[model samples]
Target: MSIYLCISGIVFSVYLIANLWAMSSNRLNQPGYVLTDLDGLVGVRHNSLSRLFSGFTTLVAKQHIRRIQVSSECLTLFTDADDCVNIWLSDRYLPINANYAKVLFPQAEFVDSPFLP
Candidate 1:
């Protein structure tokens, strides 16, 4: 019916607008750090939505990071015994390679968080 068509058109328009905004904003350009036992990865790009909500709090030191934890949704870098830097990841913007991380931190823990980007 005309009513259904109208609704579908509105939904499509909204989806298109949101996708364009995300692309234009380059939503994964925030600086992040990756840590491993033998080597450290720094200056990685993080999700823009995560940075916007969490803000930058801790500065990770390459020498201090002890472990790296990766999950489907996020990457957590631990340092100084207890400190952690949580970086959210998006499928559209994967700044780091998960396979490379796995090779670097073979014994690292993987956890799932109840958050989405």
Candidate 2:
């Protein structure tokens, strides 16, 4: 009985250690999206796992972009097809500015509108 208890304790310790390491390394595979600058196009990337498991379903082309609107909460991208993509700004994503817009979408007009969209 003592031997079984010792073995079970060891196994539990190993499991706890593994979980701690995974949490510290952020390998738990959280659901989130990242925007990648693809020169002329903006790629919307989903999933933080291996690229083979991830998907880029939405791609915003530079030439097709009608205008770029920035608000206090988020940045909106208007396309020629009347579709708007909102990229919410946070402290992690950095503050919005004209230089940042130019670097991200150089061809599109950056509109600093008061409207919150």
Candidate 3:
């Protein structure tokens, strides 16, 4: 009975340690994990599958990005051919810094962006 209790205690301790490690991980702070101003207008999160497709697109991609526009709550990337990708700000990520945005996206225009404080 005593040996069984010791084994259970060890198992519980291991589970607690693992849970804490996962909770404190910095995965969300990475470039592709959470959108940040540092990524500029061209940065998009890439998983394994998306990374493969992105490589192919970069190889034969002819579309040229014209400008990026930031509004109070959304970011818009414009291409020379009228194509665009929009990202909306939410509670999922922290607010963006204005200085980084300007530095990263030199061609970007802003319109009363609340996130750029």
Q: Which candidate wins on TM-score?
A: 2
Backbone clash count for every predicted candidate, in the order shown: 0, 0, 0
For all predictions, the C-alpha RMSD in Å is 9.2, 9.5, 10.0
Q: Against the hidden true structure, what lDDT does model 2 obtain?
A: 0.56
Instruction: Name the candidate, 1 or 3, with the larger TM-score value.
Output: 1
lDDT of 1 by residue, 47-93 (tens): 44333434533344455556766555567767658877665555444
Looking at model 2, residue 29 earns an lDDT score of 21
Candidate 3 residue 70 Cα shift, in angstroms, is 2.8
Model 1 lDDT, residue 71, Cα: 58
Return whichever of 2 and 3 wins on lDDT: 2
| Candidate 3, 1-117: lDDT as tens digits | 999999999999987775444333455223343333333234443222232233422211223445656665455556667676554433223234223334455555544445655
In candidate 1, which residue pairs get closer than 3 Å at backbone N, Cα or C atoms, i.e. clash?
none
What's the lDDT for all of these models?
A: 0.50, 0.56, 0.44
Q: lDDT tens string, model 2, 1-117?
A: 999999999999987776444333322221123455677776643222221234534677878877877676456778888898765443234243334555666678878766544
Is 2 or 3 the stronger prediction by TM-score? Answer: 2
- Give the Å error, residue 71, model 1: 1.1
